[model samples]
Target: MSFSKSFLVGIGTGLLFGSGVTILCIRLQRVAREMDSLSNAIAELATQMSVLAEHLSTLRGFKQRKKRNEFYSASSGDEDEIFEDANLSFISSDSDISKGSKNRSTEDKILDTHVLFNKVEKLFEGDEKNQEEAFRLLSRSAPQHSADCGFHWRMSKACYLVSKIEKSRDNPAKAKDFLQQSVDHASSSLKLDEKCSSAHRWYAISLGSYGEHLGSQEKIKNGFLIKDHIQRSIDLKPNDPFNHHMMGRWAYSVYMLSWMERKLAATLIAAPPEAKIEDALESFLIADRLRPTIWKENLLYIAKCNIELKRLDEVAKWLEAADAVPVQTKDEEEAQKEIDQLLPKYQTS
Candidate 1:
């Protein structure tokens, strides 16, 4: 009986030892996984730091340029006026007053619209207060202005400009309101003249901007409309670089949407618009080809798309190109910051 008890005790001890070993191995595996995650997190942090350094360097450069008044020269003068007029010309033309007032003649109304357009153009370069003043002036005259065919386009441009200023001020709700007004004016312009490419472009831009303030489901719902309007703009003006850039931006935004966001979108909508990084890259490439060095944002966007696709080698080239592009407006300065952040990652890699 003693011998039998010894053998049973040995069997129990063996089982306990084996169980302990198995538990230890499982714990080690869990630890290994945790270490791997930590390592990845650290690497990501490092990359972000490198990008931040680049942005700091760009900021320094911007300050130096400011001291030398380079930015002022780049954004001012006759060249600047011509550029603005080219984009805002929908309102620059003369138009007879649809409403006959005993006091004002057709020529007088046309001259008034022209003067207002010039005032708004000058205000475009001013501060937030200036933009608000411009908005007030435009608002007072919008009804009478829309009576003139040229006024529709001008009012649309004014609304868009105000929305952009609001967005820059971090008042997205106010921006959305202005964008809605822009859309209304753009629609009126299109109704009066269906072939107005600028109207289509501004309309698409307003819708896209408005989408940023919407809920996930509403954004998805408007995504289709945004795509349609942008495409129409491109069809109307195939050679316009801005239209292609807008298309690229749309694709990039769609591609960046998370799976959960997409699922939520799908549940709310019959069919959500689909986008791929490849499409975004192609659109950006086409825009770059059309405008060359006109915009740094295009190059930065291409680099971002490449990074998403894990094409690390190509990212450096695009970033370098972006750095070479001259920074002028606030938007370009913002793009410069992004480029500065990204350029260091690939350079060190």
Candidate 2:
């Protein structure tokens, strides 16, 4: 009887210990999940703070520029004062004062356009809501300065940005529409000022983006135009890293065409521009040298291009670099997602 009681007591103790261990493990898993949630929340908060800081810096720059302009006008002449008083005091009905006022108004409009453009540019690193707000503000102000070349160029860029936002939201049709608008604005800017390198660059980008949404035949037909504009942009701004990046993307797109696609392109149009992975790799390398790791997409594209060329070593190198780039925009985050998937596969292989 004593032995039987001792065995029953042992079994009871064992069951209690196992239950305690199971409870402890459940608690540990819950803590881990909560820690992961907190970590993600902190990361998102940091990104938002960074965007806000950049927006504030842009605003500060605009204010400084405005003050400088005001000081310049004040020290230059009393003409502005006369115009100001003309409406209030009416001491002078001089037509010269009226003309001066008109000129000053035009300058004011240009300044406003500049400030707004800077705001939009800075907001590109922000969230979709912020981008939408910037787009609305630009759309409202840009139309007022239709004749301003800088305004037109900035508007083209704004459209392109909005197109990207739309694309991210899975609205391809709207994105293409925005790209078309970008092309129109860029063309207008060039017509107003033929030497505007920004206009040319954006025009090429918008044209390429628009063509990408079209049929293969249409893409072939527009291929030369895209290449010509990209070259023009590079010639106009040789030091611009973005122009080099654009050239690289163009080459990559062309190199991605399959034999069937190339044959169809040839049938549709005469002599579509030749493209090789070597050219793509070279262009991307140039861009990387010029602006080293500032754009994660550039690194991603370089990796992809290297992969296409069967240079797995370079591909792994670029993929590692891309993993190190900070995610600023949603697009960059998406690019990082792709890198996350590709890195493990190629790294292990």
Candidate 3:
């Protein structure tokens, strides 16, 4: 889109200032070619980034895990390893946001922030009631850390989960509203700190969800941006399993675009996203290996990707794996039902 804009503006300005059409046309055409070359270079760079993300994701935890193994080997003890988060930088009670509340002690402000953060964190258990309550609290809370990026990202998450609940309840209008809120809060988070990976992740998720219902044109319009943000998230936090899972899902969606959808994208989207089912399967496999059985949907999608690839031999294995995962939430139950429906066809075949 920027490419088109630059091309048009350059040519228009050239003609408006009484420049010769021949020279002007040649100059602008060269510029267009250079822009196209730059765009292709960008696409190649993106491919490299995805490859680097997948290869380095497991490396992040290797040193820590190896140290733990060495400690256990020497101690000959079976105590669960404990990791403490010494980074309590977000609990800033003395920050400018708390200037009006001079009466509150620093400890009190810190405690209140932790309490609010914990409350929101606990509500992410996929319970609709809990998610709704969490959203309400996030909407009303005015803590010292209210301006913190961490707080806004959590708000984005709470809004996203509430949107999920509304979507499950078939309340499309309400769901859309919450999804927008999710996107807005995520923008606030990014504005505070562009380096935050989870903010990028939630922002991608919320925008993708919102785009899904806006028909083909809007989906195409948001496709590049949604993908870029998610890729940025993966590059920043490669060790996070959910980030890989999201990349897999995004790949699968693009790979499965219908004939008409592809045509629309070709016509309307300057740089429509592209992916192969193989890419989807590879991402899903990486996610599975990173944290086996962590998410029922991940396993389910792995099976679905195999089915699409005509790899019937591999499909049941993933389906069975998904089945063995305990169903703890409504989403997991639904995923299990899908796995059940797929399991029989492949088992008998």
Candidate 4:
């Protein structure tokens, strides 16, 4: 009676022990594979950081170019030399930018810059914080996604913020340099993805700033390109209010060209760029409708366009709307300051 029972018990114990060992071996193999994968990733990241350091070291050597003559033709953009100077191009080609035909978001993050885009958006969202910190984050994250168009545009935005943000404005030379970097990063964004609306939008805006800060010739010459790229941005993403506001700015500048400026353009350019106050007003109004109470700049420009049209009542109406917009950032404070300056003149007129 005891022999059969003992034999059966031993067989069962042997089978259980073998099963436990098999499961443990499988788990150990899995953990080993994961560790190897993690180690490889860390090594690759270290290599990228090293390469990025070299590129950025070269970037630190950037010197400001001398001002061009006023007679410089406003025909072509003539910006190759500036880009050639910065030499900040990145070759990171393995970043995951595989969104299909249209943009699809991963939960809250849009534009694949390793979720840094969301962080960057928040950096500009609330009361202004350390500008240098934002620039550092973008620079640190850039090399890993150098081939990613998203990183380039975001880097351009960070450069813009450092250039024009309140305290940063104290250093005009640094601001100007950062502004050029903004243009360079933004242009790189376009080279990587021409169809990207944000890239085109930022590129146009940065180019416009470079022209405005650098010289009148640059502004007047880049005007057509700004108009074209901003138009493309609008065409690509019709719902973006920022694009509409930019388009309005282009139109307003054209309509406000002085008689001398107009004569010069007519003489030099066979078909000088043309725009009307009504067109600007229309674009501004559309932006107003698209995002109410967000952009006081859009409201101020709307008032300016109306002032041009001799619509004093409408001017007052828009100024009131501009005044109502809550000011958070220094940029918003500056926009409000402009409104304050314009209010007395328009109220009396």
Best by the lDDT measure: 3
Root-mean-square deviation of every model = 32.1, 27.5, 24.9, 14.7
By summed lDDT, the worst window of 10 consecutive residues in model 3 runs over 71-80
| Clashing residue pairs for model 4 | none
lDDT by residue for model 2 (1-349), tens: 2334444554555567797765665565455556655565565456545644554554456544322221111011100000111121111223644554555555445445545765665564356676677778878876577787767766776787788888878998899898999889989988997876777777777777787778877777677888888788788777666677778888888888889988887888878878888898888888778667656888899999988888889889889988887665566677889999999977745
Indicate the TM-score of model 4. Answer: 0.66
TM-scores for the candidates: 0.63, 0.67, 0.68, 0.66
For model 3, residues 13-73, the per-residue Cα lDDT tens digits are: 7777775764777687777868775675566456545544533432333223322211111
* Model 1, total clashes: 1
**On a 0 to 1 TM-score scale, where does candidate 2 land against the true structure?**
0.67
lDDT string, candidate 4, 1-349, tens digits = 2334444554555567797765665565455556655565566556545645653443332223222222111111112211122222222222422331122233112223423544454454433365567688788876676787867877787787778763254877887888899999999989998988878888987898887575555566788898999999999878767778888989998899899999987776667789989999999888778776556788889899988888999899889878887765566677789999999988755
Clashing pairs for model 3 are: none
Better by lDDT, candidate 2 or 1: 2
Model 3, clash count? 0
lDDT of 4: 0.68
Off by over 4 Å in 2: 1-106, 170-173
**TM-score rank order:** 3, 2, 4, 1
Q: Candidates ranked by lDDT, best first?
A: 3, 2, 4, 1
Candidate 1 vs 4: which has more TM-score: 4
Clashes of each: 1, 0, 0, 0
Regions of candidate 3 where Cα sits further than 4 Å from its true position? 1-104, 142-145, 213-215
